[model samples]
Target: MAEQLRLVVPLHGEQVSNMQQLVSVMLVDDEIMALNNLKNLIDWEEAGYTIVASETNPRNALESFHKYRPQIVLVDIMMPVMNGLELSREIFALNIPVRILILTSYKDFLYAKEAVEIGISNYLVKHEINEESLILELGKLKYEIQNTETNDRYLRQRLIRHLIGGLLPPENLEIGIKNKYLDFKIGSLAFLFAKIDTSYPILKEISVVAKSHSNFIWDIFNLANDTEYMDAIRLNPDEAVFVIYFKEEELKETVREIASKTCKKMQERFQQDYEHTISIVPIIVDNKNQNIRNIYSIAENSFNYSVYMGKNIIIDYESIPTAVNSSFKEVSVILNELESDFVKRDSESLKNRLNIIFTLLGKPPWNPEDVQNTCDRLVFTLVKFRNKNSIQDNPSKIEISNLFNLNSIRKWFESEFISSVENAVTIDALRYSRIVRKILVILHHEYNVDLSIEEIADRIHLSAVYIRKRFKNEIGITILGYLTKIRMEKAIELLSTGEYKVFEVAELVGYSSSQYFSKVFKKYSGLRPLDYTSGV
Candidate 1:
């Protein structure tokens, strides 16, 4: 029965309830019958505890104890070849918190005194150990362990905050190290700052999953290969910071390699699971004289460069250029030329000029503020041209200012700003020809129908090849691509009303398979149709 029970027990760290985790127990006795009796003494799982290991030899018990690291150990006091007290001494020397209950036959006061002096939690006289008595004792130990864990977690979080904020004093650091709250050694320290890319369209919705992402990323870095110790703290809803301690100074390159691998894993997991991306900046502080604040500041500064470097990559601090460029006059010249292109209604020239400006801005030595100011100036120039030309449609100031990165800014310039300008331009018969207008009408009105490019071309008495080329040239996207975009937009509207199920939305969006529709929806919007409806 003891062997069978051990086989069926839940492993340590398994969840017992939403708010409670199973406490693990290890049984150590020199007698096989006594060990089996202890295992069968009570229903351990019912009491929220699991018997991970049971041993008849004290030496094997010590080995199993280290391997399982159970919170509670029940050992017989009168064991041969390394008695229970000697084993307890060895366990205590490891400095890990564990409750030891001595099972003894002795009734002497001296025996109990020795057990207490050796940090034994409680002793159960072997003959008097009933199921009720054992359960009561285990209850007290579980409560104490839970309290200690809660306090330890709180202290660890507080200390990490202090370290990151540069407020931890030398004395506090000493005390934290001594008390085992901070897991730092005489080793080289570095930091990895991670943040979800803010330029994602549904950032507000993404914030709902930020805490879970933070925990997942923390686990990734904490379990990083070759890392001696790691601790992480969430700096905000969108960002987290991790401090990694390496035991050897020569592992600097090892740190970068591990960080790179970790970041790649993070990218793969996030993209595959969440359909999202994140930016990680790894900073290795070479100067031991600097404090934690200086190290964090360096990582933070490196993280800011993600705007130029783009998303889903590791930005190494040492790789950044040290030189600064302040060529606002050259940027002004490009802005003036962009305004000329806009006035000429040359959409192609406008695209080329915007690309030049963004490419120049992406080069090193420009700060975010410099980019922002340049972007603001460009918005002003376009808005001025629109106002002078009496064009009603223009990108709002808020939309222009809210762009967070170079990629997002460039996308906005093309899609929102330039597209609006193109639409407002006086339609030349040679440009926005009658054939494209008819196709646009068909797409907007009959989007839910199974209309293919060939069928539409046949309906309009044109060849499919000619229409496909004409559509792409005029609309900047293929007919099918535009159709998908329209369908997805309509689906969003339908889902926002909270009146349609996913399948219904799928059908209304011209998709035959709801499963395929969901996949496409997630890829298009970074959320499932259900998540959008549920406001997640």
Candidate 2:
């Protein structure tokens, strides 16, 4: 027979002698049996630092520490009442340099180090320590605690500074395209524009998909550090714009494949989760050195073409017919109406005319492909008109210039005419009014000093007379009146802050004298500055 075997049971109970009052001992732990064993193992008097009381509850440790002001504390790493680290932090807050010895399992060394960093003096490995080792470590820590000072008062201030330093604001497309740290070289370059069929909520789903599948798209496109791709999707509630960068010419097929796959995956993944369809426009980047804005235009035009041609189809600009047979007479009539409506600020009428033009171009039942073809013709025709006007403005009698070349016309249209159209439309009457609002803000913020009207005009890229007229028409006030309003508003804010006297506030916000500023403020707000702040 095998020798009679005795299995060792973990020590789970504390033993204390009746001579406990001579040196009080405090043990904090979540495991009742373990806490009891620790109490039994340590001889309080031999260690020099006496634990005043023993507690299993961590929340009670703070009150006990404050009450006893104990010279030593033993805390467990894993506790139910409160974690040892949290309890140590609270104890440190009391401005007491008590020797905190951590009672943790041998497996808790990582946590023990962290505990020590938070002001714990010694980390005692439980189930391995006996009376001799506990007293030896505690005797050593007692000397350190006697000379230590608690600097825990500045903890929150340091934490807040670190948190603030970690925060960063988001960057938009301008920054993304210009970021030098980001690598943008890929094997081949291609652009995909994804348009969502529903409103903003619906459009947000595709944006989520785009971000999720970004790595898949990059891998499928075979992008590398020296050869990478960049993509951006400007999302509206109803529509979205997507632009991609890859190796020119070579990656066209992969781009189309990835784009189509992405759109398909997005549609299927989101259809059950959301109601939306994502359509894609695939365009090849022919010139990497060309302006990014030009690449943007190509992608944008291709996307618009996608909407016109059909939904969810990849259309290449090079494959499309350069010349389409259409009646320019009808197109010219439509353009005249559009030009007049734009000048008159009749957006409703312009939208109606545009709809009619699209309809006429589509013929019956409205094939979008035909409409796209017709719009291309319209753009070409308008570009030709602009070049003819330019030639007339700068007449050259040189016979060599008369030579006909289609390629030259195409380049001129892309490089010059398209940009001109963008600049013209972007600052039209609608956008002009927004610019005036921004100008008003600038004026109010800087009214006390001399601001050059020419400089302001140059900033907005409009003539002085044009600025004055447009500002007046849109705002129902001259630049001076608007500036005065802003200055007066600032004066009221300053008076309310109570940091300055009424007279000082007036001068600070740009008025030379308090009396004049008060009179103007009264006229605008139905009360003088002093009376207003005084509740009169």
* Model 1 TM-score on a 0 to 1 scale: 0.56
Clashes of each: 0, 15
Candidate 2 vs. true structure, TM-score: 0.24
TM-score of each: 0.56, 0.24
- Residue-level lDDT of model 1, residues 152-197, one tens digit each, is 5445556767767877534644475435634343345556787776
Residue 236 of model 2 has an lDDT of: 38
**Residue 195's C-alpha lDDT in candidate 1?**
79
lDDT of 2 by residue, 53-102 (tens): 77778888777776655667888878875788889899897654466878
Residue 442, candidate 2: how far off, in angstroms?
Answer: 66
Off by over 4 Å in 2: 1-183, 198-232, 239-252, 268-273, 322-536
> How many backbone clashes are present in model 1?
0
On lDDT, the leading prediction is 1
